[model samples]
Target: MEYNLEVAELEKKYSNFHLKHINIKLPKGKIIGLVGENGSGKTTTIKSILNLIKYDKGNIKIFGKNTNNLTKIDREKIGVVLDDSFFAPILNVNDINKLMKKFYHNWNEKYYFEKVKKFNIPTNKPLKEFSSGMKMKIKVLCALAHEPKLLILDEPTNGLDPIFRYEIVDLFADFVSNKENSILMTTHITSDLEHLVDEVIFILQGNIILDIAKNKIDNEYGIIEILPENISKIKKEDYLKCLKYKNIYYILVDSRLEFQKKYPKLEIRKPTLEEIMLILVKGE
Candidate 1:
């Protein structure tokens, strides 16, 4: 598989905090969900990859070339959507088009216009007049207008409504449908990405707790809700993680066969990505 971004030993430190040595690869033709709590280094990792922050140690390779060595043209091939817009609040959509056109060698005005129309984003209105969701849509349109081979998104679904979130997720799917384009999206909203992400990369306390194929995780892991009395009968090794919610015991098991054979009294259930993540992150 061709990798779009390779992060090896990526590290950064501040006076009070340190984004410890991190490693992960974003492959082409798939959507990777970079998930973690608010302070789990998700944004820091993204910044390191984009060279927005100075790193102490590590090498990030983008499109087979080190990220530190990427030229202007090479850098333009990757589009990014940060948490906020770079455009002035008073600027209209046309101003953004002109600015980005001058900035990107491969900017497509026609494509941009088509996307704006599809999303019903008003070009005549100033950006400050747009709603949060509309502004997000504009950012997304701008990212894709340049025909980038890789898309890097940070909290792309942060403030959008359910309807628009679904629409944007479909947009991302369309973006990566060509098999040459790839996306690395970091968001706390895991359900919005449930249908889109091909791989899952979980970051916790500056460390990657889980990095695996989405299908493999789903196929191998299950949520077993067992009685509090029967919890002692189940082997700890059969489970990846477990939790207790008031009266119910939520156990996460990788192999159901062993559990089924060992504990017939337990009830096995399919788990959502959010459930798996919550349990893994809880560490109990």
Candidate 2:
């Protein structure tokens, strides 16, 4: 099997916080969503893959080769939008175009110009003068101009208007349409990714809680509601987690068949990703 990126037992410690052993495999040509609460090591994982942060254990591979062995050509194939302030405040979008052209041999000027125009970003204005959403658009255009095979985005959706955020997410869908390009986007906007993400990787407190396809999650996990009468009779282990809101109980179960066997009269409903994450983090 071929993978675009893989991290096995990668560990990083910063003062009091520690990113425990992380094992992740990103297959080629897929959009994988990295979902987590604030300060959950999403950026740390992205940095580990890019070799921006030092790790104490295990190995990280890009394109099947260890990150330590990554060549210049390998670096050229991976693009990154790490943060909102990567570019100098004085540099404008036009200035960035000139800068990126020199950095990547495969840079496409036409593509860069087109994206800038499509996003309606003012090229001559200083980056600091532009709004947060405009700056993010410029960063994304810079990454995409070089025709990179993989995009590692760290919280690219932060502080953007709803319209632009949706546009940016749609742009990601267009990015992976070639089937040769892949994206590992770390974001808190799970609703924006509802239909766009191919795989969802849930990270909590530096540990991966779930790694599976979006369709599988929608089809497999369910929110089961048992009436006051049937709640006591239901097997506790069969339900993975549960919550109590007001006077009703909202239960999570992995398999509907198993849940139904025990509580045939119970009503089960499809749970959203946000709902699942809430139940995982906050128990009944």
The candidate maximizing lDDT is 1
Candidate 2: lDDT of 67? 92
In candidate 2, what are the lDDT values of residues 57-166, reduced to their tens digit? 87998898999999988899988897744878999877888888888999999998887888788889998898877888888887788989988998887778898888
> Residue 270 error for model 1, in Å?
2.3
| Per-residue alpha-carbon lDDT of candidate 1 for residues 1-284, written as tens digits (9 for 90 to 100) | 89998899988887767887688788889889999988899999999999888899999999989887899988888989988646889988999999999999899999999888888889999999989888988888888899999999999988898988999899899999999889999998889778999998888888888887888766776788767897887778878888887777899887667777777767787678888778888749
What residue runs in model 2 are displaced by over 4 Å at the alpha carbon? 225-233, 246-248
Worst 10 residues of 2 by lDDT: 225-234
